[model samples]
Target: MHDVVIVGAGPAGLTAAMYCARGGKKTLVLGNTYSSQQSMGGLYENYPGFPDGIQGIELSERMLAQAQKFGAENQTEQVEKIVPLSNFFRLKTENWQYEARTVILAMGAGHRPLGVPGEKELTARGVSYCVHCDGALFRNKAVVVAGYGNGAARAVLYLANIAGKVHLLCTREKLVAESVYLERIKNLSNYTATFGAEITEIQGDDFVTAVGYKVGNTPRTVKADGVFVEMGMKPNADLAIALGLEMTPGGYVKVNRLNQETSMPGVYAAGDLTGGRLQVATAVGSGASAGISALQYLG
Candidate 1:
């Protein structure tokens, strides 16, 4: 049995593996190609210490190399289920089963689709979810913030300070997020709020030039450099639920704050699956905590 098995290859999982290996534990990281960090395009500027910033793929590669240098093994496989045994946890992959003394879940969150025509085709060209990662691309330009939750409100507040104008759109009649966030966003003069609207189409050839939405009986369109979809994300918590770990009402795994310890004694969680601001830096930090906790559990 391995000392630890990390269930992702994102920043969080890689950081956990590095810490575990450095702590003298044998570590195995299992992940599928589809879940790799390369899918997130553009340069990450807020990752600290990078003045000019680094590409997401480059940052991920650096982390992966660092983990490998510490002797952590990686496997490209989708874990099917996890079964806890007498003395170890059994990780059942699609092709086989392996055992480990401890496990860390850092699979992160899944993006929500806008479900509008031309959205998939114009993803990088004009659609994005991360404001810190892509907000600079639209500096002094008009952008659309779609949603009314905390993420949407936060994005609108941030964009209002940078972008020339911000259009905050929501399908719901009233904001469903925290009252404080709504109050902050409403005070911005550059931000305009639209309610009970649903985007019908994202139009542009090879890029997004404008967005079409309907409010009540009227259709409206806005010219924008890009559209930020702040509709929130779905956490990858199936394995945690399968292993009988407790989850919050939002479907994220419940964990102790500092150590990132889950309900299960030998299992832990970090990153977006545990819920918070979904940032790479926070992911790595939480992963470090989970790794240290797992090491202590093993000891």
Candidate 2:
């Protein structure tokens, strides 16, 4: 039996692993292979302590390496279910099962698809969810954004730096997000805001060619290299839910603020799965909290 079993490999899980391992707990981190932060191309500039910025995958590697150095074990597996033990927890995967005295849930956010036609098949070909990773590839090209939230606004601002022309398509009546981000997007010459718009379909023969949307009473087409779907994201907390943990109305795991403890004893949660502000730095802080709580519980 392990002392702690963390169910993700994102910033939070890795940070937790580092702490638990250093505290002399046997730590095991199990997570999905591709959906984690590393698949988003690893470039993070906003995280603290690193003024120069770093790649997303590199950052994940660094975290994993640190945890390894402290004697944490890593595994790639899809967690099927988590069952409570008399004094511990049992984690079940497709191929294996393990026991742990404490658990940390940090599955992070899952990609929220546009749900429009041709979105799935044409995902990597032209449709993307991450602007920071794919924006540069469309440099000097035209692109369309499909949301009006802060995530969409940030994507537009980021894509504006590379794309020649960016069309902001908002599902809502008007642009309503952070005033600072709204102001920045509004000031950009290459950025064009289209409120009350919705993407109907992504048109492409093999790759993305253009995007068709309805603006008020009219239908319009925007030529584009890609469509950056910044329409928010959903937290991947099904495992936590399946295990019967208390969750917020929006499906985020509910935890005690200072200790990151869940309603269930010996169970803790952190990161975007716990759903506060889904930022890298905040996730790290939450991970530390969960790690310490797990250590305390195990002791």
Candidate 3:
């Protein structure tokens, strides 16, 4: 049995592992290869100390290396279930099982995709969920931003600066966003936004060439190089739910704001799984807290 087991390889899990290992606790981090949502991002400008900005995948790798340097073992096996014992916890993954004195569930959320034909086949080949991440790829190219939520509106504005022409396929009759989003699109010269867009299919051979959408029953197709579907997020809380941990009404793992402790003793949760600001910085901060708390628990 190890001292601590962190069930993610994202920013939060890596930070927690680094702290726990450095504090003399044997720590193991179990996760998939592309575990962090940040890995799906591109040039992250908001993260501090990197004025030039850094790629999300690179940052995740750096965090992982740092955690390993501090003696945190990294495993790519995804956890399938967890069994809480009297004194420790047993984690079962695809290939192995581990027992740890303390457990930290850092499994972050995943992006909700737009269910449309060719979307699954065209992802990364011109179809993207994050405009902030993949927007740079469509620089100076015509692209379509779909949806009417705050995320979609923000994408329309952000891509207007990057893409040559941004056509918005608003899925609702009216934009369900703050006034700022609605007002900003009106000033864009290279942008056209319309409401009640029904995306029929994403047409492409090898790469995305156009988007098929409709304004009510009238069908239309817009030639574009990329499509950015800006829907909201869905938390990865299956393990938390199965563990019987207390959760927020929104289905996120509930944790103490002060120390990141969950409803159960010796168990902690951090990052998007706990449902906060959902920024990389906040995840790191909460992860540090979870690590320190795990150390304190062992004492």
lDDT of 2 by residue, 1-299 (tens): 99999999998999999999999999999984245754474456677878988877777888889999999999998789999979999999999999998899989987688798888878989899888667888999999888878778778888898999998889899876778777877689998877888788889989899888887779988888899987777989888889989989998899998999999999999998898888888999999999998988877
Superposed by TM-score, candidate 3 places the C-alpha of residue 261 at a distance from the truth, in angstroms, of 1.6
Q: Which pairs in model 1 have colliding backbones?
A: none
* Model 1 agreement with the true structure over 1-299: per-residue lDDT tens digits: 89999998888898999999989899999984235533363456568989987877788878888888999988988888999888789999889888999999988887677889978889989898777678888889999998868667767877788899898888689778777777787689888878998889888998889999999779999888899997778888889898899999999999998899999889999888899987789988999999899899999
Model 1: ten consecutive residues of lowest lDDT: 33-42
Backbone clashes in model 2, listed as residue pairs: 42-55, 42-56, 42-57, 43-56
In terms of lDDT, which candidate is stronger, 1 or 3? Answer: 3
For residues 1-299, write the lDDT of model 3, one tens digit per residue.
Answer: 99999999888999999999999999999996364787866557679999988988899989998998989999999999999999999999888999999999999988778888999999999999877668889889999988777677778878888889998888888889878668887889998877788889999989999998888689999998999887667789999999999999988999998999999999999998999888899999999999999999999
Top model by lDDT, which number? 3
Which is the better candidate, 1 or 2, if ranked by TM-score? 2
Please identify which of the two predictions, 2 or 3, would achieve the higher lDDT against the true structure. Answer: 3
